[model samples]
Target: MAKLTDMEELASKIIDKNVQSYMREALTCYMTGAYRATIVLSYIALFDDILAKLDVLAKVNKKAKKIYDEVSKKRGNQEVFESDLINQLSSNNLLTSLDSTFLDILRQLRNKAAHPSGHKPSAEEARFIYFESINRFLSKEILSTTQLADEILASTVNKNLFPSTDITTIAKVVRKELENIHPDTYPYLISKLIEKVPSSDGIVSKNTSFFITGLTFDNNDERIVSVVRRMLIEKKSQDEDYFTMIIRSITSNPIVLETVDDVTFKRLKVIIQERISEVDSTLEHSRFSHPVSMFSSMCGVLNDEVISNNFETEFSSAIEKFLYSSYLLNNLSKSEYAKEKYIEILMSKAGSSDFEVANKFARTCYTIIDELDVILTDQNAFKLIVNLLRAASWNAFGAKDLRNAKFQSMPAIRDKARALDLNDKSEAKKIYKEVFGTDTDYENLMGKYVR
Candidate 1:
């Protein structure tokens, strides 16, 4: 329990605190790089339902879906790609309140990513993917539709883009085209564009004030409830007019300091580190009209502040201050369940094909084991087993089954994986039988293991 003095901070911290485990996993996976695609793909396919519920925004909306169908039909046609897609949306009855002009812009990027040799999204794109996917697919109605709109629009403003010298630049071109949607979101879109762009002109000023204003706010509304969406599967480019509008809009409604509850405060702390200079400190901790259960998160992902000044220079001190705050994180880590859960998430991600992120996580876990007690406890030992199993065959199973899978016997699972080194199915099986009862195995591992 939190003491009275720290109640406010604790309240805000709750929101940010819940996901450190997942974030830890993501970070480790990021370092390995081998399991990134698998992790991302599996996450989407597996947790499709959870994501759908939580998602405050849908990816295709009605407009994008219309275009999607048309594009699918004209497999080889390039001349009228946009028209084909638009027609398909009109025909499919997927059309809704969202704008088609924006869908036109989105389709191009989606097509590029889906194309055989087209570019994959960069880290920024990936982050945005996580954000929008969560909003469209998994997020609950934390705010009303009106408030939801406001949060998204307001957040987008902070994610502004600066002027580019090159008018013909692909990213800039993309932005100009997307203005039909919110027009204000262009700056953050530009931020995402730069994140996806390969060594192109950088987006300066991060999630600062340069923003597009006047977009309506979305309070949690029931209109889009229980709807599954895949909002952003690709990243768009930047444009001059869109960029200017975003910058102008945000400057007009500069991000003010937010008076956050504990739940939101931790989130602010985590996000603020990206690029401190651009952070509207006053704005980050402010209170909003949304409910805790259904509020939209990941709004800060595209904040121009992150893309502006170096986060190292901008947010390091603030992060440090938060970490040292009277045994806050220390207490959390000391809890065996929490520590083990964190490790399980991290290690699971580490046991992937992406060697860089995987290895990075493994090393981090090693350090934790050597350094932290809770992470290495008897309870955690079993927890590690469950995590290992989850990691060893993440892509092989349905994500929906994860929640139901028994984990009480993780200790045995861990020992089995290690005894066979996750390489010899026979040895692992033999060990499994010994520990789990039944099953005699010396050969034909998969066949026996399946039994």
Candidate 2:
């Protein structure tokens, strides 16, 4: 039932160009009513492709290497070489029993077509051979082994091969190598990469994270989600450290949270909650700062439902407490970055459809602005105040009234607003008018408040 055009299109998917050339010739023969030549040429292409895959497998697998070596010695004898290759592949578990049987049938058809037999093949028989050969052998990559997976993972560490800081570029490099790997190898490859997450520190850590994130988010592979869920479940009880590290990494790529099942998501929520609870603002240097910042970053991306149910109170309180404490504010660069993340989290939360959620965030921002005003002696704190105000004013959620009230009540904030350059003041007035539907006369309110 297969048409010559369909057969040629399938042949084009063959990764091996040499095999493609042979299949092209076979299709040409099939079109010309040369049925015997079509069968012989298609079989030759399939066999050659299998041999090419064997060579690649041999480089990474010892069993494949042994089989390849034996096949190489018998290459002078065509019949013996073909028979030995199939037997060795079957014996080594490289080819399934069904696959071996299929190859054997194709080989027999090739034999019949090559010899001067009284029997002549029909068009259907030749088309069947062409389609079977291309689909079963020529189009698929070799079965991927653990060693091959490791080889691919190892190659990712080479800077020359993966030299991009951009995650999209790095993911492309990873995908190019992984696309050739058989699908059966994905679970093992994923497990190995997960194991690497806790220990890998530099570029290796980044590549591993981006690759896993790409699989889950970019490719939308359900198998990846299932594997990660199963692995996390196993690691949760068996290896807490491994489980925690993976959770931390997943928080960095929070879109992954959207893919997990509810139970797994709830577990992740509890773990993140436990981690955030350990943050001690009193300490001169809390080791938990990183996790807190990560959680804040995650909150900035998650939807209102997840934020309200899992993180609303805890995250808001944590950011407020951290901002109020001197520990973060004392470190200029770190404090600026943390403030930026905190403001982003608040901005996202302030957009919530739930009035209580959005209103609560406005109150948090109001209090944070008060704290920033107390610390306004620090030039960095002053800049953060302006940034937070500018960011908050842009969100048209239920918080606008609360923000306007706070702005009117705070004299120091009024003085700071009065000191703003023309562009920033104009930008602020524009956004405020856009958000609150009113233009505030900053010049009129200047003398009424004491700095």
Candidate 3:
């Protein structure tokens, strides 16, 4: 519907000079009653715009550049033909379904007009080619590739431009363009996007979640870990979903735990310890779901041997403090398996030859005193006494004092074990004999306590 004057205004805005010239010639042919010429020339202008855009975008996209190179080679430095551009754009998602259909219609019209097999279009059809197809579709699509890149960047950084648009759609377009044109910006863009999540949760649209996850999947390494660290530190509140998302992504990712450096690992350990401590502080008032869930997820990272090895001392200290302070013993009383695991970790540390480690483990053992009725199995009671003895062997007290202390504690252990009926009296005798070896004083201690 645009007149020659209006068409010229549209033509002047095209960034590609060649495309502008072709557009003008096509418009001129249509106005001068040259219907067939207008159709052919309009198609030329549209095809040139597509090729020029593809060429600029391809500078950053290896795949797109590869296709462009092939098209150039086969066409011998001539412009890429309309059919080739349409097919490639359709496959690449640059053109939507309706866009492809319109392009197909133009291609068929161009073929009919150019090849000259008795298909002469009327003036009205020529008007449609020049004003509707060229002006509305092709020319409107022809922003300089740099302009296209800038527009995408603006949509991403400026929230108001595409207010209703899905952030993930914008991210997808940016990724596709970068995969072809600006591959180097992936890290920068990803970091910037992550920054958006904390300052304004709205910026991280639901659609954008997949984009964030996809970045981790493709680059699951130290850089991703660093991003997670910063995000966790920035998020001081107990946002369980945020914590859950990061922990699950990082844990399931292959290189995250393996490749994290010592400094970063230590930072992560401190953060998790702080979270667990927070939960411990509130154990009596709350039922321990939220922080417990967070801590449980973090245990996945701690379970890694390399991380665990580096964090042994700190880890032991946290477990000791948490168990000693919290009512976790009562909470875990119903879980036979958890009771076993807790005892194993505690007694293992208690068995250490190092006095400090043994003593720390011993203090943790004291917290379970009241819960011992249901918690101590026959096997654990044996292990518990063995651990206590091992710890006593490392006692800072002299060996003479250590001997006397062990002599004294054995009766109390026997009485407690027997009071609980933890082991058969014969089995208790067997263990006592193995350790005491027929000493008359030991035999008296055992005889007085065994019954």
Name the candidate that leads on TM-score.
2
Alpha carbon lDDT of each predicted model = 0.33, 0.61, 0.53
Q: Worst 10-residue stretch by lDDT in candidate 2? A: 442-451
- The order of the candidates by lDDT, greatest first, is 2, 3, 1
Q: Which of candidates 1 and 3 reaches a greater TM-score?
A: 3
lDDT-wise, the better of 1 and 3 is 3
Q: Which should have the higher lDDT, number 2 or number 3? A: 2
Comparing candidate 1 with candidate 2, which one achieves the higher TM-score? 2
Model 2: per-residue Cα lDDT at residue 401: 54
Local distance difference test, candidate 2: 0.61
| Ten-residue region with minimum lDDT total, candidate 1 | 225-234
Question: What lDDT tens digits, residue by residue, belong to model 2 across residues 1-451?
Answer: 7776788689888878877887888888988999999998887777778878888878767888998888877775543678777887887767767778888888887778889877699999999998878777787777534556777677546556656645467567767777557776688888888766555556666556556654543444656666765665434534545544554445434555665556665665566566556655454332322445445445445564665566555656566445433334333233334445455554445455555655565566555565556545333322333433434445644345534454565556555655552336665455445433565643442233211
> What TM-score quantifies how close candidate 2 is to the native fold?
0.58
Instruction: State the lDDT of candidate 1 residue by residue for 1-451, as single tens digits.
Output: 2222332222232223334234334434444553344235424331333222223233424344334444444544534454453444334432222433434434544455555655765555434433433333223222112322233333433323334322233234333333233323333443443333232323322222222121111212112110100011111102322322222222222231122234433333333333233434343222121111001121232243322222222222432222212222233342333333334444445344454444444434333333333334433343344343334344423221321343222334444334443455554544445433454432343232321
Model 2, residue 290: distance off in Å is 5.2
